[model samples]
Target: MSQKRLLLWVFHSFTLIAGIQFLQYYIFYNSSYPFPYTANLVNSFGTFYTYLLLLPLVFYSAKSAFSNLENRVQRMLLLVLSGLLVSMLHLFVMHFVNWLQIYQWTEDPFWNSYRFLISKWLHFELIAYFLFVLAWRFLVFEKKGSEASKPEYWTQIKVKEAGLVSFVPVEEIRWIEAYDNYIKVRTKKDKFHLVRMPLREIEAKLDSGHFKRIHRSTIVAIREVVAIHQDNGQYRVLLEDNSTLKLSRTFKKSIEDSIRV
Candidate 1:
């Protein structure tokens, strides 16, 4: 995540925590709660402040633990582990702060307080972790959907061949072939240009509807496909230049759909 985004989350979380704690304290103060006003206020403020101090660690760990995890079981395990670690850290810091306030860092009383706090706050801490993860996932999903809906207009691709630089217009390109650590750009005029870039990287820059990957080694422009021939359960893509390229069974359906559309 970018520093700006991290800072924005921190600010928003702080505001949310503060607002909730304030309302909670106000409700308790007005109600017939048994707890003393001073003690209630102290605990409320302490809990909120403790979470504010731990926000960075929690956010960083949650992002690292949940991001890119595809397995459901493994992701759940990591989430539980991360939540436990964050809760333990929060408990330790809260106790240390309390000890500082009382000027007593003794062992027995600290352990007792720690146990009590854990028993009372553990479930809440886990819930907080899940809530944060849900919000982060929602934001990411929305960002991806917004990007996918935007139109892509690629004009040209810059290519360097033999120490000479040139710009190839997107429409003139007929097909592209993958070479080891590079790609061979083929134009409609039957000219070939070598570019030192991966075909997958180049593919991402092209219009998705216009260019389709027919095989691991070939990506053909949809407009340049003259015909598709199938024989013996295999397919051949015939391009406008009369060049035949093998169409992998994996991408055959996608290529056919794009052409049909």
Candidate 2:
């Protein structure tokens, strides 16, 4: 997994407990029935604790579902199975907690509380599982759709706010300069931002005909180059607009070969 994805998972897990607590409070405070404070609190804590205990289960399930499978149908099956497993785990924990409560305190001898808790468990687990699956689909797989289609206009263009829109057409954007979080597109317009996609993902979608990596931080458009000249130990690509694009030696041979052909 990439660093960003790892960080996102950590954030999601951390916030999940707080979200469950908030939801529990909302339900209790807004309810018509006399709130069973102790019982509801116990159930909420159980939900939180169970989810924590099942962290590894969910992670491994999601990982296995999405990993090393070239076949789309097989991957989808694994994903469905993983989601089912998570929901089942949630249900089991809810029932197990109800059994404990029944054995501990007979003051409130009502099965409705157990049923309500189980419903909550099902609701939260299903939503979380669905989110997990959707997140994996978006991050792990590049779906084919209209977004991948090419536009007829090729030459002159303009981009909006540098941070909001990525003006670097996939074809014109050769490489990018990735900063702490943002990336600057080195397009025919020079280094500008027309999109906010991560550097790695953008690199994946770029057509090899027009762009490729020259450095960890740089990607250059092939058609933009007017000439490439050796500069000491490194290289420089002069574009048709007279702006220079850097070319590391690692990528020099490929660019040279492209130019030769």
Candidate 3:
């Protein structure tokens, strides 16, 4: 990760924990018989800062599990285990901090309040652990998707013809259609070639700016598209070559976004 991304990730982690802590503090402080304002603020934010100690553990474990575990069940098991370990470490740290800050103010020994603290915060701590995991997943996937959106599309498709292999400029191809197990790559001049490739695979290779899938088994060149006709909520795409193709209901929104009309 870059320095900028690292800082952004840290900011998100702190924001999540700080927001939760603020809400928790506000609720407790507004209740009847609340503790003194100074004590309440310090104790609440102290716990928030202590949570910072486990942020590294939470993010590192989540990242490791996502990278190493492909199975959903395995990932969940590893995350649960990591969450348990983080909670254990947090409990010890919180106990030590409590003792250090309140030894002069309270009579309760640190060891004596272990069970009380567990009862008060164990479930909530586990909840916070899961929240950190969710935050990591959201940030990581959004970054990956943002980068992948600007992919370099294929320029030329290899063509194997007769006993010799050739090349077809992607611009010359008018549309592609699925023909049984292979795809029929058709050109504007009415010539066609069959290739052992899936429609979806070829569609991914094409630039969305130049070609758009109008159906599950059909992709048309944007320049070849002349007009669209609609009737009874169904759509048909008319091409300049006098070929008309079904504009599937599922792909209607995709066409609208691509054509911007």
Tens-place lDDT per residue, model 2, 1-261, is 542564467566756765678576767673653445555666666655666566556656666665567787997787677776778767777667766755345564446555665566666777877775566446543342234555443332245583553334465654566776666765544566644456676666656566666667777777766688877767888767777767888888887777766
TM-score, per-candidate, Cα-based:
0.53, 0.41, 0.53
Model 3 agreement with the true structure over 50-90: per-residue lDDT tens digits: 77767778888888787678899999999999998888678
Cα error, candidate 3, residue 135 (Å): 3.2
Give one clash count per candidate, in the order shown.
Answer: 0, 11, 0
Ranking by TM-score: 1, 3, 2
Residue 71 alpha-carbon offset, candidate 1, angstroms: 7.8
Residues 67-97, model 1: lDDT tens digits:
6677888877887888788878877777776
- Least well predicted 10-residue stretch by lDDT in candidate 2: 140-149
Q: For model 1, what is the alpha-carbon lDDT of residue 82? A: 80
Instruction: Give lDDT for model 3.
Output: 0.79
Worst 10 residues of 3 by lDDT: 32-41
Clashing pairs in 1: none
| Alpha-carbon shift of residue 183 in model 2 (angstroms) | 37
- List the candidate 2 regions with Cα displacement exceeding 4 Å: 1-36, 103-124, 136-261
| Position 195, candidate 1: lDDT | 88
Q: Whole-model lDDT, candidate 1?
A: 0.77
